[model samples]
Target: MKNLIVASALSLALMGGPVHAQTSAPAPAAAGAKASSDPIVVMRNEQRAARNAFNEAARPIRAERAATVQAAVDKAVAEAKASGKDPVVAGRVARRQATEATKPDFDAKMKPIIEARNEAMAAAKARRDAAMAQR
Candidate 1:
């Protein structure tokens, strides 16, 4: 009688087993639908805009620097002539001096841009490091 009860319990448990249904649905597409706008086209347009802005911003600086250097050269030539030195030698010396004089100004103008670029690169490196660590 105990054995019969055990068999009955086992049969009942077997009949009450959990059931799972197999899915016939296809897998979802790997990526979202293609962007309405092409990425390459957008990137190229952005690049063009950046170039235009850079050129516009640089124009005044270039013109000002040219004027300053020219003035320095002219002054040097005049002084050299007054001192009875060769005009060519004076012009060469003036160019060297003007280049030296402009160094500080040029560096000053570029410092912020350089620092920003360095900061951006550092941030990118940090992000990359974090991503690699996750992997």
Candidate 2:
């Protein structure tokens, strides 16, 4: 649950870039530190950067890959229907085929950005854990 929250927060933080740039008011500081100097603040910034980079890198490839996946799924469904499979079964098969066909390319293209984000999240988690331990 906590991990899910972290991932969601990271995604949201990254999707639109930095919050400070988007808002007129200054960002609130982290406890005991200036906002800019806070570790979590730094992590969030890093995540935003990674997200921006990923978006730029993935934009063209993503569209092409999505089209490929949709085409594959459509073909799969048509073939299954031609074989007299039930509609529900055909749809499921199509979905599975689409995922299988796209997974490798998607991972190849997105792995670096994902790794950076994961590393940032892990570091933040470690800091949070250590802080709790000291308390």
| Number of the predicted model whose lDDT against the real structure is largest | 2
Query: Listing every candidate in turn, what is its Cα RMSD in Å to the true structure after a full C-alpha superposition?
Result: 24.8, 15.2
The lDDT of model 1 is 0.66
Q: What would the per-residue lDDT of candidate 1 be over residues 16-97, giving only the tens digit for each residue?
A: 6633122444435312322213444444444445456556666677677778888989998899899999977988888888
Candidate 2 structure quality by residue, lDDT tens digits, 67-104: 88778777777887789877667777777888787889
The segments of candidate 1 whose C-alpha lies over 4 angstroms from its true place after superposition are 1-36, 113-135
Q: Give the range of the ten consecutive residues with the poorest summed lDDT in model 1.
A: 29-38
Clashes of 2: 0
TM-scores, one per candidate:
0.52, 0.45
Global CA lDDT computed for model 2: 0.72
Error of 1 at 71 (Å): 0.7
Show how many residue pairs clash in every candidate, following the order shown.
0, 0
